[model samples]
Target: MEADHEVAPPNLADIDVSAWRELETAATSPQSGFRFLNLCSVDSEARPQARMVVLRRADGPSRVLEFHTDSRSPKWRELSTKPHVTVLGFSTQTRLQFRLQGTVELHAPGSDQANAAWDKLSPWTRTTYTGGPPGDECGFEMIDEAVLPKPQDDAKGKPHFGLLIFRARTLDWFQLRRQGNRRALLTYDETGALAACRWVNP
Candidate 1:
């Protein structure tokens, strides 16, 4: 006996979203384009700290982006207090850049989303957060480590494992080409509605 499979028709609502997804994919391709964003976050004193982080996930239709970090890290605390953040992604291969400004929400340790993400993490990845707090000063040059407990079988589930969700409000896209530099600013209003999109010379 032969099995049959059916393909569903594409949804028209996904057209614009698909375009943005393509852009994200091209920007995050491992071989040519891996590191994209230089995420910037502010401390309690309003001091800015920028770091390079991999773009783990993106949902253009929902206008959401995901990035992971140590829960005990200072940046996590900063994000908890101040939810606003800025992410800058540059593709050296295409000389294209994307700047994202958004508000972030930290998922609780054992929340459904957090649990799902933890399940997907490899044992090596889980070991990093096995220690106490991330940024706590141990006052030691280096210390030998022990075997980390598995997430599922361990008595204490991944303590400091968490996920950050950024709800993007505006996206600034720039393209650099040999012929003419181009840039575009796509802004969303405070009401969560896409406001105006315009092109400018880079």
Candidate 2:
């Protein structure tokens, strides 16, 4: 029999389910701690580059994730050169951290994936891609304009808008707690099937 005041510890299966559920929630919820991921990639100079990217999509069954990016950004070029990346996110509320290693697939302009992602963007988000190239100097006066998501304006941004699809090869999940910490590693096969799951020391 269990003690009345004792709490139940989650098993491996429960932890796996919870991790995926949190990821799915993070993709849709703005207030989610995991909504913003720190994406790291290697640059041409063999140095690591890190940037914060929004979590646009999460599919647990397929072990896939997606994020939108400007096609002209340096990260885009770097990722194009080396498709491998590390994505990290954490939730203070839950004390859970997710670190994912994966290869990214870029969907260029007019591609089916990019088109679908672009259509889902709100008018305000669509305006982000209308500006000058990312990381470019403001050579001219930066005037403020209420850029509405007009068809033409949206068209200008379309060429710079692209989608990055991440297929996870492994996931490292960790939970921090006062009493004790827990960690687990989940690996996926080439076909996106979960190949193995095991708990590790935190």
The TM-score leader among the candidates is 2
Q: How many backbone clashes does candidate 2 have?
A: 0
Candidate 2: give the clashing pairs.
none
In Å, residue 81's CA in model 2 sits off its true spot by: 1.4
Per-residue lDDT tens digits for candidate 1, residues 17-118, read 543675457435655353446779999999998887666777666677777777888888899998999988776766767787989989978889988887
| Model 2: per-residue Cα lDDT over 29-85, one tens digit each | 999999999999999999999999999889888888899999999999999999999
CA deviation > 4 Å runs, candidate 2: 1-8, 139-152
Q: How accurate is candidate 1 locally (lDDT)?
A: 0.70
Per-model TM-score on C-alpha atoms: 0.76, 0.90
